[model samples]
Target: MSYFHKLIEIGKENAFVYEYMAVMDSENRKYYLERALELSRNTKIRPKDYKRCSYIAFQSFAWREYDIALEYANFAYDAKPTNDIINLLGCIYHHNEDYDKALSLFHEVNANYEGLNPYVLCNISSCYKKKNSNKMAIRYLEKALDVDKNNKLVYYSIGLIHAATGNKKLAIENFEKSLEIDNNYEEARNALNSIKE
Candidate 1:
């Protein structure tokens, strides 16, 4: 088979592994990730050639291996600076508590993409919240809501910002809205319970 054909096979294998990972079976996920790495290595595939580095970084992130996650995320970013990879890199930085880097990447993606993406907006809000910029966080959260009002995560994040700002009523309202959208959202339920009002 040609190199492209081998790459395709590797991609299929990685997809299968990812699907298992989503089901919360860590052992099988690890198995597939390792296998994917092996196949890529045998084919002399560069880390950036086929999103292999990103998948590796995501697995590291899943395992809470922040350092490894950062390394792989960098490789992925270097390979193809797509919005998705940028977002992943931002998330890794956020996990490492490097709020500045996370915020910078999030803004970069948000600025380049003309259409509004609720996830990007919410992630930027999260980075601001981590930096204790409640006002900015709320602003972005509102923007996310404007883009997608039914986004349960945005409502939950808005509730968090309100709670942090001591706006109990608004917090409750947003949390309730989140629960209305996703009845099984434990974070929204917990936030609602935590609020005295």
Candidate 2:
């Protein structure tokens, strides 16, 4: 950590140093991330370091720091709008309750990508679910299953929609399928238990 701080002191414009410091310092992570983002933007180091921004965006999203995630994701998208970056930005939008925008971006990925991507399909399903379009949600999840029949999350997601729509039988069956695929899936196990109760 001190090494990183020393590097920063010597080369204050080094966005990578600030990003590294962000990874090393949990307590001051947001501050370090912000500084890295600021410097990276001003220094126009994006061509060489956009992936670092993408990584930070994902980390921020995982930590539920949606604003930080959005900032980094937008920057990364502007620098290089790869499919993964677009999907990450869509996820951020979904979490922020901007379901329409998220859906648009997810569909864009689905249409442009060559092969089937179950995760992207699941994300689309989630946006539909949020919009109270359970039927559409189920449709997308079914597509996900078509791509990967044994995908635990797809089964679990189907179970959730069924459970929400008061179709306990289908919900239980899907949850069971999820557990069959991955018995260690705690979410499926808990959902099954709750359904039974």
TM-score of each: 0.75, 0.92
Over 1-197, each residue of candidate 1 has an lDDT whose tens digit, in order, gives 24434655676554334434433556555554555445544443354453667776777787876765676576667677778888888998898899999999999999977539999998999999988989899899899888998999999998888888888999999999999999999989998998964
Cα lDDT for residue 124, candidate 1:
92
Query: When superposed on Cα atoms, how far off is each prediction in RMSD?
Result: 6.4, 1.7
Where model 1 places Cα greater than 4 Å from the true spot, the runs are 1-48
* Worst window of 10 by summed lDDT in candidate 1: 14-23
Residue-by-residue lDDT tens digits, candidate 2, 1-197: 78787777787547678778777888998898888777766765455557888888888888777888898888788778889989998999998899999999999999877439999999999999999999999999999999999999999999999999999999999999999999999999999999999
Model 1 scores a C-alpha lDDT of 0.77
For candidate 1, list the clashing residue pairs, or say none.
none
Local distance difference test, candidate 2: 0.89
